[model samples]
Target: MLEISIKPEVLGYIGAFPLTNAQLTSWLSSLLLIVVAIVVGVNYKKLPSGLQSIIEMVYEFFQSMAEDAMGAFGRRFVPLAMTFFLFIVVSNWLGVVPGVGSLVSIHDPAKAVSAGIIPFGAPAVMAEAPPSADATVEEQHAYVPVFRGGNADLNTTLALAIIAQVIIHAMGIRTAGLAHHLAHFKNPLEIVTELSKILTFGFRLFGNVFAGEVLLTVMGSLVVVLTGKLAPALPFGLVGGAIAIPFVMLELFVGAIQALVFAMLVLSFLSLFVKTDQSASHH
Candidate 1:
């Protein structure tokens, strides 16, 4: 069965909190970043080269943008901006990678129900169950993917948005003084505008990533169905894969763009409030 879950599938739990696949992906992305940062830090060089060069190039590009928007003060924020972009881009790209979603673990329906992983009413799924598995056996086993897109889950995106907004507002208060920053919020329109940014930041990323996941899922499934019907014995996997190549490439580009957009939005908001202080200082 083809399962398209809007909510992330639960992988396990930490005390009372259920750990979803999206959370797992985010943790993986964070770990990868930490490892890379450590490697680059340990191998520090006077003149940039290889991975260091690539990292320098991207960091410098973002730093320039930050400085352009908020003057020298913006340089201090490039780290935060870079963190947002790097984490999101990696999470997005990982979603499109083979085996991220392709790999799965089979669960016996009875066991899954007892384990509280799935409801008895839910249809069983199989990523690639073995042949010779009887109908009775098939009904007993189900697929629970080991990985899923991080941003495809709303909880992750909303958390990002909330964090960005909180930091942005905190920066504003710190830079402009609490009285000055709160004065701006006195305007009902201003308050509404500030609140609306959370929705914009969260939903925009969530919608794009979730839509991409669904598109790839549906496209791959359609290709399989068509190939199987049009040419029996023609490996549907090969045909489906070939058809998905272009979309996957497009998703890679889209993922990068979305990440950049998110980072820029955060910086833009930061500048919006921080600039008030800078303007006052200039006068």
Candidate 2:
């Protein structure tokens, strides 16, 4: 049965802190970026070739886009924008791969079934049956995923949004003085609007990525169900797997677009603040 969880399931704990599948995925994604950076840094050549050429092309593309967006000021932000774009796109696409969402088990059979996270009949095949009437069910069960997309989790998205907003505000203050930046917030509505961006940024990324994850899961599950009904001896979900190939490709495009959109929005917001600073300086 397919399970759609809004929150990333707690896989385990490291001392007092609980580790989530989303966090694990984020860490792995960051590690991947770091490894790539190190490899590119070590293998640099005046005349680029192969992976180096591709890397240079990507850097040049973002550099040009950033420069076009905010003039000279944008050059200083190229690294941050590119980091967000690359990490997010990689993480989003990773979620579309096989075995990411499959290595999950029921955390709480009764609760999951009650909450519609698992089918009522799922308990039959679950590793452990629910406790008997007099027995106590354990509070936690092993519901861990090997990998999950970082952008699909609200925490990851919200944190990114908060960080972007903080950088924007800091840049605004540095460019146009704290007093001048604060003056814009003198209007209570303006304050509210700025704060509301957290929700907007977080939900936009979370909703899109999460929806894609759920859609793939449901589609795959439907394939399994249909195949089982039509041909009981047929391999489970094989037909569904073939059908989902196109959707996987679509997800790859969507992931890249979402990353680009996020990076562009950050650049746009920075540009707005930069413009404000420029206007105030003229006064």
Candidate 3:
């Protein structure tokens, strides 16, 4: 398993509030996406090439998927839905990158490389640490990165879930009305009963994405341990990379599927709320 510690302060403040790793990751992801988008947009043309073509293909596929899920009317929400999907898919795949497990840091500089012990009077300074350390080698404190896949982090998935659900509510209200939307909770005997189901929508998405991360983690560990001792040839970089190719592709598909599932669930839930509101109106 990859374990990285990140100083909370490294991420900039959000109106005097420091962001969490997951939040920082989200910010970084957004920034990187913007840069990439600008690069692609600058070169966009009638006959797209390289990154532009890849991006266009992804957009088109999601456009089709959104339409299929929400029908012709769904196309209006395509921009928001597709953007969320692509962002999630990219972040999910980032977890499997080679350095994800290897990136780490040292909290102390001198202690990181001292002769089995830091001098009592050593000055305190931040020092770089290796991602992995050798047992025989002393004083090399191993470091792990603070950031993991945004999707792998429960906070990120949950935030996304909440945002998605909120969007659904907003869309529903716009289509229906505020009185109808709010009435979803009011008519129920107890607010607790109504609120309980609120968690279900978010939790389902969280569970699916979280489960994917767990499965990938377990499978990756097995691959490393099994290949290390049993088959040297199998562990060769090219062979290992080939073996991993399938999983990477699988992640790609899962990313898109999960995004679709999340969005579809949102639409379905909104439809239910619309119905509930309409029913209350009649009664």
Candidate 4:
């Protein structure tokens, strides 16, 4: 049985803020990026080798892609595009790593139930059976996963989308004067188009990542259940290994493609706005 919840589980708190499992994963991803950046900076070389060479190659690849998209102006936005691509691809891949979804946090069943966090009819395993006569009344029994993929959370994806849009608009204003940028919005439909970009950008990444996570969960659960019934002595983990490997590879490809798609779209939008301004200026 799978216990799938759309909302991210609350793991704990930081001062007045509630920290979610997805947010925790996002924090870890950011930390990982920071450490890698520091290492690359420290190991800089006049003649690139090893990690520095790899970093240089990746930078050149993205830089060339951006150049092809927006010519000279693209150089200014390469950092933004590269950041989005790297962060999102890493975050997506992290979700598929072993132990990420397995670790769980225990909570008091009575408190969890009273809080109305669990639905009216959820799997019994999610909250465990009622405490036995020998058990303490306040014993914690409910278990929730401690980590989830960052992009699987709507809040994270939406935040990324909002940031991208803000940068796009800012670039527009910088390339064209504020008055000219505002003039484009005089048509009411253009305002609607701008608003629609938020939903399009946010939901595209969120839906794909979230759906992939759910599918993997369901597949793993099914394999375990089937294996347990067929062979009581055999470990389900071993038996399910064959079935899980292909999906893992598929997810890796999907993650990279999604990252590239998002970065390219950002570049395209920026180019569109800039070109529009250029044409207006010549008139």
Candidate 1 at 46: error in angstroms? 1.0
Please report, in order, the local distance difference test score of every candidate based on alpha carbons.
0.80, 0.76, 0.57, 0.77
Query: Which portions of model 1 show Cα errors greater than 4 Å?
Result: 109-141, 227-234, 276-278, 281-283
Please give the RMSD to the true structure for each candidate, in Å: 7.9, 6.1, 8.7, 7.7
Q: What value does the lDDT take at residue 73 in candidate 3?
A: 59
Clashing pairs in 1: none
- Superior candidate under lDDT, 2 versus 3: 2
For candidate 4, write residues 1-283 as lDDT tens digits: 4567777776654544557789999998999889988999998989999878987887887899878767766788889998999889889998888867666654655654443234334443333333355432333336667788999999999999999999999988888779978988888999899888988988999898888887777666566566444332346556565567788888888988998889889988887666543345545
201-259: candidate 2 lDDT, tens digit per residue: 88888988998888777666675555444332245458667777777887888888989
- Top TM-score prediction, candidate number: 1
* Model 1 TM: 0.84
> Residue-wise lDDT of candidate 3 within 1-283, one digit each (tens)?
2222222223223443444445555666777789989999887799999999998887776567655555555566667766776677666666556654323344554544441222234343333232345312223343324455666565666677667666777786886689867777675664564354456645664565556655554454455556454332334435556656677668767866776666556555544544343345545
Query: TM-score for all predictions?
Result: 0.84, 0.82, 0.63, 0.82
Error (Å) of candidate 4 at residue 127 is 15
lDDT head-to-head 1 vs 3, winner? 1
Model 4 compared with the native: what TM-score?
A: 0.82
Q: What is the lDDT of candidate 4?
A: 0.77
User: Top lDDT: which candidate number?
Assistant: 1
Candidate 4 residue spans exceeding 4 A from truth: 108-141, 225-234, 275-283
Is 1 or 2 the stronger prediction by TM-score? 1
Question: Candidate 2: deviation at residue 107, Å?
Answer: 7.1
- Worst 10-residue lDDT window for candidate 4 reads 122-131
